[model samples]
Target: MPMTSTPTPAMAKQTPKQPPTPTAKATKATPTRKRPKLCPPDVTDRRRRPAGRIAPEALAAERGSALEGLDWLGRPPEATASLLYRLLRLVARFIIFVVFRFRIRTSGQENIPAGGYFLVAAAHRGWMDPFLVMQALPSQPRCWFLGSAPSTFTSRWRERLIHRLGGLLPVWRGGVGIDQHVASARAVIANGAVFAQMPEGTVSGPAGLIGPFRTGWAVIALRVDAPIVPLAIAGTEELYLGRRMVSRVLPVTSARALAGLDHGAEMPPPGTREELDVARRMSDALAAIIGPVVESIHPRTVDPVEHPRRFRRRLTWLFLRPGRLDRDG
Candidate 1:
């Protein structure tokens, strides 16, 4: 009796190896719940939780975002949906006032993607193209509209508005300021926003053939290793019923995004002999999409574009740098 001992129930129940970690017990004891996604809006609306904690089943009855007034006009959506709507409407004002009267239609809108940053290039046909392209766009993958090249005539309010809407970028008017521009464009792309530019330089006006292709666009694309999307719009002059027919013409033309390859270092430098050759090929590629209409369609006739003071100042450093020659005795 003295030697006999009853086995303890606790000892019989335990048969483990190593000790458990502190976090292991905590994790095992707690149940994890998934978080709700707050990305872009969905195709369909889900019901709102009543009492701020609606059951999953209650989601069927909730209303989504509201669009009252012209609040939804802004482009380049903000973190908040309501804000995005407002920005979208703001961008639309240009179209409503100017482009709609021209009947500027947008064709090949299917070409524009729904999201992310890109390098958007359009053949400069008329001053009207930027307004038409920006306003009539079907989608803005988080638009960051770059303003026109520095012009002396731009109003302060207009400048402020362009920047406020995230539409401000400098463009070199002529010659080969390609490398310098690529630096500026790189900043935009790096920031995860779109960089929009007109490769045609100033408006085509009624005169001047579409001019030779500018290599700066290709250079920037290759430098950033970004896709170069060519935008071809026609009918600004042809469709201009002064201010009425702009609506019809707005929808015409085509847009193509050449996401082919990075075009990286493999591509020639802009303005170089090699670059010129490549740019010509790109121009031809765009021409194929636009066809004969562009050849015959004249630019919306307008006065020559003038550079603004601020732009001229910035460009002075890049463009007006005279070569300093050392005169030796």
Candidate 2:
């Protein structure tokens, strides 16, 4: 055999490599894990949130007690003029006359209806303005006031005293207890008495400046079909002895007429856009009527230098509660 040789040791160990076969475990699909949904924090968690963030029902219930411990609104309209009311009015008048020596002057007394329900809308400048208006009006049908509960009832004694006097209809600010307030006001009007309110809502800046009027008065007047007797008070902003306080009653007008709506026309449902528009127009008309009167009596801007020297500075703080004496204007 021509050149046939024996294989080497390295050639015997060498072989061709091949791909491995696939198995069932390698072809299977992996499962996906689902995540949990997120949610808002609980309002009842007192430690984590503020106390004011309570439920609507809880808030209403809390605010409904604003007039609690007072029996004024529970009485019949005719019976609302209790003896305490007359006595308190007399005492207030005595203080105004003898203690303060304030000269009371009134104009357009004839504008006030002799015997009927009416609304007295006035610009509020000070705590004493309400008492001044009460003094100016006749005492027959007692006047009921829609007062801010927090401002009026600052203490237990004040709350008790005001409750005993029996003429205030407590209303909380920020729209709490609004329905009850409207109902009480309507009751006062239906009782054939005067309902006095400050259209500016709270004491605005010094005596002469009138703040923007709110629509509550206009809305209530329209709903009750009562005439509004605009009252412009002057000289109570800054108080001193021998001050001349004037209560001028403007012409009596109806909210419906002021809003340019037909007399006795049905009002849109409460809180509706149409109703709001009507109230706004009525409030604007009211402001137009009363603005000039107030400005004429009291200058728009008062200089501190022109203020009369108060011998006893405490006299200026007479109407303000002790708690508010230190507060700045």
Candidate 3:
């Protein structure tokens, strides 16, 4: 028989009992810590962090820009016009200023530039738009306006006066005489004065609703590498072509208008989608100066608008051009 050994009292005393496992109820009762949200607790304040204060460097840059603008203004005109041009400009300025007593408020006039070539892409609200923009300037700088022919100077006397004054040049739409129109415009800028055109091609309204821009202005800007200044003319919608002559009959307050200039936005590569996109953007800038009057009357419809295939490529579009329509249906 094999000998059997029994454990000693000391060894038995060394063994320890295991602790009990937690029950399902106990585990479920424990609270879990949650991860914090990235955004602020108050949705209204939305900012995750405090607004950044303007840096000193930014302030210095602004001052430098202002100084540069002054230097530009002090520079000489690109080219001088004849004495006759000067006299005509002065007379027209006097008529608009002293006679009509047109009151205008302007913002961002500094963007007119110091020298060289630039074009004003004005939003046409009524016949007086060109006159309003021209007179709004602090200095009466001579500008050649591109007008629509057959319709611009309807009467013989009006035609003769405009021709003699050497201010208005006609641009025939529908591909008729477009080249000549462009050439004449080039000549004007070559002589140092600025050229202005109502890019909307027609009057939209006083409230600043702009229509499609004609490509002629964009082509000119690209060819000369000239900057295009966006100009918005407001408060002259009531002075439509029919009412312009008798505008003085209205209260002096009705003659008041506002024009705002947006800093020059350089033209992108010519003939590219960017060209059309930029022109549209400039139209939007011109609309801002018209104020909220028109908007209140015909509040913009929130419905979606359809656009052409070419326009779809624009990354900066708010949504198909505001007034675009579907190709079919």
Candidate 4:
């Protein structure tokens, strides 16, 4: 019973079990194919293209597009009449500085770029504010203004004269022809001229009080890729009364910041709530910058809190009527 049992005959017939066949050495996994890198549209072609080479059709299309859009007063004539322009500017400046006896204090003339497009905006309370802003810039770059159409174009002769000056753009209120005006501004700025607009849209508001700013300036600034300069041209409120006008061209703010806007965003139509909100934000930013300067210039006269509201209400009513708000004489 204690003896081990012998294997069966069938088991004996079977050969001693051999070690299990070793699996063929596992082959390393084949590497996966990598995706090709994507190139930018400009470099999509593998062949190196010559620099500045553009298709004739593309160039022609661009040229044709440029010629279209609302007609600007005219192409900037700075190069053809640089001297004459400067001379005329000087004479006009002299009249403003001497005859008007404006104080003409400026803060950031250096902020004005020597060339290229930019927007100079101010709290407009009178016709002279735009002119003062123009003269205040030490650079004195060729500038176009977005002025009220009815006021500036009162006569054909007046229109011709303003158009000849090379920076006069007329804007209609109550959202009429705004697209054309904005397009015109784009064209002027695209041509490398300075564009200036009174964010307040008119000169009827109280002095030193910033009224509700219009959205057109933001639209132009954003679309034109121009930096907005919040210029403070105070004291013009008393210009006719013999008080000196003090104006300062403040530091430049990116249009995006001033308007709280981004490039290429569809502009809300003029006078709409969305547009007004954008304008109000821009005005707030500008007011923050120029409020102190305005106060220092005309501390006793500034009643921003009460006066601007009343003026705006009156303006809202006038703006709703059939005729233009006649410009200050």
- lDDT for each candidate structure: 0.43, 0.67, 0.46, 0.58
RMSD of each: 26.2, 14.3, 21.8, 23.2
Provide the clash count, candidate 3: 0
Where does candidate 4 have its weakest 10-residue lDDT segment? 313-322
Residues 32-101 of candidate 2 have per-residue lDDT tens digits of: 7778565555644436432233332343365566442123456655534667777777887888889777
TM-score per model over all chains? 0.49, 0.71, 0.48, 0.60
Candidate 2 segments exceeding 4 Å error: 1-65, 68-72, 77-80, 299-308, 311-313, 319-329
* Cα shift from native, residue 322, model 2 (Å): 8.2
TM-score of 4: 0.60
Per-residue accuracy of model 1 over 34-136 as CA lDDT, tens digit each: 8986665453456653333332122212323321111222333232224654666676665445544334444455555443334443445444555565654
Candidate 4, after superposition: displacement of residue 9 in Å? 99
Best TM-score among the predictions, by candidate number: 2
Q: Candidate 1 overall Cα lDDT vs. reference? A: 0.43
Cα error of candidate 2 at position 197, Å: 0.9
